[model samples]
Target: MSMLPSARLLIVDDEEDMLRLLKRSLTADLNCEIEAVPDAVSALTLLESSRFDVALADVRMPGMDGMEFLERTKTAHPELTVVMMTAYGSIDLAVQAIKQGAYDFITKPFEHDKLVHLLGKAFERTRLIHENLLLQKRVREQESFQEMVGTSPKIRKIFETIKIISNTDVTVLITGESGTGKDLAARAIHRLSQRDQGPFVAVNCPNLPENILESELFGYKKGAFTHAAQDRRGLFREAEGGTIYLDEIGDISPTLQTKLLRVLQDKEIRPLGQTKSVKVDVRIIASTNRDLAAKIQDQTFREDLFYRLNVLSLQMPSLRERPEDIPLLIQHFLEKYSKEFGKPLKRASDEVIQIFLSHPWRGNVRELENLVSRAVLMSPGEVIREEDLDWPIRETEECLVPAEVSFLPYKEAKAQVLEKFNREYVSRVLMRNNNNVTKAAKECGLERQALQQVMRRYAIRNKELLSNEDAE
Candidate 1:
């Protein structure tokens, strides 16, 4: 027997004769086990007692109707496949059933082959859905940390880094562009660390003034300052035997950096206007988008504090660097928002997905998630089509097909097009720099040799190309 034929089935109908007819129709062709129930209540009872591969129910039953029965069945046993059989089939009902999680529907007096074909597909989809759920559950349970979903090598490297640093108590410095989920990474480390149960206190250092920031971090005695009305415990005290995440650490003043360095070095905190220092054991996780090395060179950031926080550093890749992860991320966001909004969004259209992959997500995962949420709310139905998505045309244009093209032979045309682009790009860079290769290389994110190679290939060697006006 085929896999579909071997699947367990449960048939539900108000009439005993109809139940019998379904049993006979399926049992004759299927090489599997079958159960027949007279009403929705009995069908539900059977479902609770024993698992079935598929459930087929009549729409107009005596008690609970097919729609209600399907909803209850799906809620109770989401892994089971459900197909509704209705004499009165309309577009509204079909769409409603599908939205309520029905696998498929069959009309009354259905042909034998059509019934079999629909059932086969239902079983297959059910099997796949169940398998994916099992795998996802296994990953969640075994990994202990949330699955950082991406197959890109850059993301893989980040995973490796997380795994390596998770077991240690070293201060982790996560440097990434804003909205890159630095906070999530910090939590993942805590989850994988020995201090998993301890409190994780996050403080954004840049959002507060110097006095308030210090007071919030170190706490204050009653009347310590104008607004210090009572004795207060600081974040360092609250984070005892736990972790304290200092976000935007680079934005803190040099004076505060000195005070912070003392906390790292001595593992003690002195509350504002307090005479004594309180000893506290805490792991520090700091994140920033600024280049701390440059800040240190400029004397804006203290070198001593920089070294303390740099013990373990992780650089998060920009969204553009890992375009391959866009599809997975999009699906993740879609499912999340669909569930949140209580809507049944099946899938994003291929064109919409392609647009997402092609766009430069400067704001990273956060931006992508917002875009998906917006689209889900605006989408009229289950499917999210291309028109449902809103993309910035300028950002997409860089990665999408160019607007203008010249006709040429297949191979030669392509070469000529590439040459023209290279020449134009090189000329622009040279004009911007007045023909200075070093400055142009920095602007283009290319090495001097690489820029020269492009120049040579395009056959553009005008010394004037290096002149300031030409570069501009």
Candidate 2:
């Protein structure tokens, strides 16, 4: 374990001698900086000027009671750990203080060992809370930039494409299956672009009709339409000097496509029922889950517009193609939902992770996120078990291949089970080692080429399990 810095402590008591004794006892065992105060007011003043890792206050004070002091301190510094000290300890008071967010309380005449143990636990809790805050901040920052969480080669390629396209003003076409994070890629481009400080407006082409979409894209004048209450700005004008993300762009009608192409060509937009065109400076980032090329060939989509919007392109890989990233994604989601639900779920079982790896996530990361969130909420303990998740795992068809035998004897059954276990173990080891044949062989105590032969015989090619480019 990594060594953490010493905790700063504040001790408050009405009795000066008791305060000195408490401080001496604590400082003798702890390497932390300790401050002793005679009253709650002094402690509050000190807290205002400086930060402390933990605060200890006596329950009975002349001016302000320990419970009130603890409550006020918590209000000021929610992250600070506060413990109450009481000579007349009551179970009711302890329960009430805990409910009010006190870290823990100690009865008066406490043992030296008990004090040390409690303070140690409090210090560790403070350290963990600090670390969790830092990690959460980092996660939030990355999420704001729309960065995907994966180190696989396939994901790295996607990241590279985003990096290259973000510096340019060219139109981008993001193509992928549904729920494959097309909008996330668009946001990443916007965040990295020169207009990063400008507004990022997203409009779904499939959600609105052609007439409504035209007016929505280019603001209409007041009274232009029956429901037009007043003049309103469209998405393009709202995103002036920024970027406009059009999701599901393939669903746009052919007539609308022509008008869109005109806007791209002219760099201007004319609102509905308006004669004059409005000049706009906005970058276009369009995404679709369909094959626009096939649509253009079928005459449903225009080739000119396709060419216009296809200045740059990015493709998102499916979860099934990058199974190695599943564990990281699971960890990410677990942390997210555990904090969200106020439950600290530690880890998923190996069986649960194996099920995740084997299943083809048709809905991609979105599906995995939802499943993990539900599991975290439903789980009764710190660890998330396979039974806590509702993920579909078919035993007979999805995982197991049939054995060639009409009736299996005990010996045959035993052999089949052992063979299956060996194959599964070998496959897991190879995957965990990123398909490094030599490393996996050494780990499994087998010859390098012998492991390779077993993998081949089991139909578990390295390329099939992990992408060839990633394995390299």
Candidate 3:
């Protein structure tokens, strides 16, 4: 009989006869691939080396008893389904095994049909779990925009705009708060553009001094400066026939701006300490978090250069403006860091997710990514709880009404405070109850209709909370 490809089983028992019987019975009856191990240690080694749909381990083993093995297995591979077997099974022992995350507990003297039935259920659970994971992956793919992940209308519009702009050779200016992935947007443009085969050189304008920044943008001769040991190909030359991304462009000095404007206009660059200007062909993409318009008025930024860079512009929305994308972003980061750190995938607990949804992500997407990366390393279990997060304590201590809010009219100030409180309160209750409105309403001591009205008033979305299965 052909075994089901996806349903692979591992049977761990100390007795050689038991192992043979299990391997033969499971393979024939369930039509599943079976690997029988003589001991729990061998089973764990197999688990570390390969994937299995379910693991059946005996509670009574020679060394590293079944209970201890189960604990270690769950710690390392929390997604693996496990079922405990014991000849001396008691109600207390069964409950203990269940508490330790066993999919099921079976007495060793059980009939063949009963064992098959229990394993069948365990395999089904594994199948469903795998299917759910694939579904989540498909959902994330649908919601993503190149390297950026978001399903919100604002982000979707940004994706559309980027696609439209990628077809053109005109200069583009990307404006957004710091850490909002302006660099990613620039790269996306270059990747989709005609110069996809050419180099993409990125320069952080604010990180270098004025003299250094100029030379870095345009190549310099061997004797250009004291430290110039040899002829250098600057970022412009390095990015020939491609795109040169100037990050934090508003921070560049006026002298640099004048030089940059010349390059944009002339389509050439004069190397440092060189009399002749070298002809170049490259696209310019600039990004800034600062207010270039205000700087132009203050004479710090050149208005002419602004016009050159702003031929096409994109404004990336902040994390706060697109709060609906937070969950998807969290999922994205969790998947990223878990694989990088070699840790079993972990999902944020309902409480932790509530905190994430409420916190003002001042650092934007980068900040959230850092937080998730740390959580992946710190969390010991399958779920990332409040303790795993960096700022849950600070989140709990935040003021409902800001000091600036007190300056408003008394009625308005009070209304704002009440609105904020209701939003936070209702959202937390819904998250705890997996967004079941009736259950959350009961927990909040409000009628279902009244709670629904409050949700409508505050624009709270039922879709914001993680479902129980999703959280796991």
List the candidate 1 regions with Cα displacement exceeding 4 Å: 1-75, 81-132, 135-147, 381-391, 396-472
Superpose all Cα atoms of candidate 2 onto the true structure and report the RMSD in Å to 1 decimal.
14.7
Model 3 regions more than 4 Å off: 1-5, 88-94, 135-151, 163-170, 176-181, 187-200, 206-209, 238-243, 250-268, 275-283, 289-311, 318-472
* Candidate 3 residue pairs in backbone clash: none
Q: Is candidate 1 or candidate 3 better by TM-score?
A: 1
- Which regions of candidate 2 deviate over 4 angstroms? 1-37, 41-49, 53-147, 223-226, 342-346, 395-472
Q: How much is the lDDT of residue 278 in candidate 1? A: 94
**Candidate that scores best on lDDT:** 3
How big is the positional error of residue 89 in model 3, measured in Å on the Cα after superposition?
Answer: 5.6
Against the hidden true structure, what lDDT does model 2 obtain?
0.82
What TM-scores do the predictions have?
A: 0.63, 0.62, 0.62
Q: Pick out the ten consecutive residues of candidate 1 with the lowest summed lDDT.
A: 392-401
Question: Sorted by TM-score, highest first, which candidate order results?
Answer: 1, 2, 3
lDDT of 1 by residue, 195-304 (tens): 98999999988667898999999998999889788999999999998899999898888889999999999999999889999998999999987888888899999999
Error of 3 at 269 (Å): 3.3
- Cα lDDT of all candidates, in order? 0.81, 0.82, 0.85
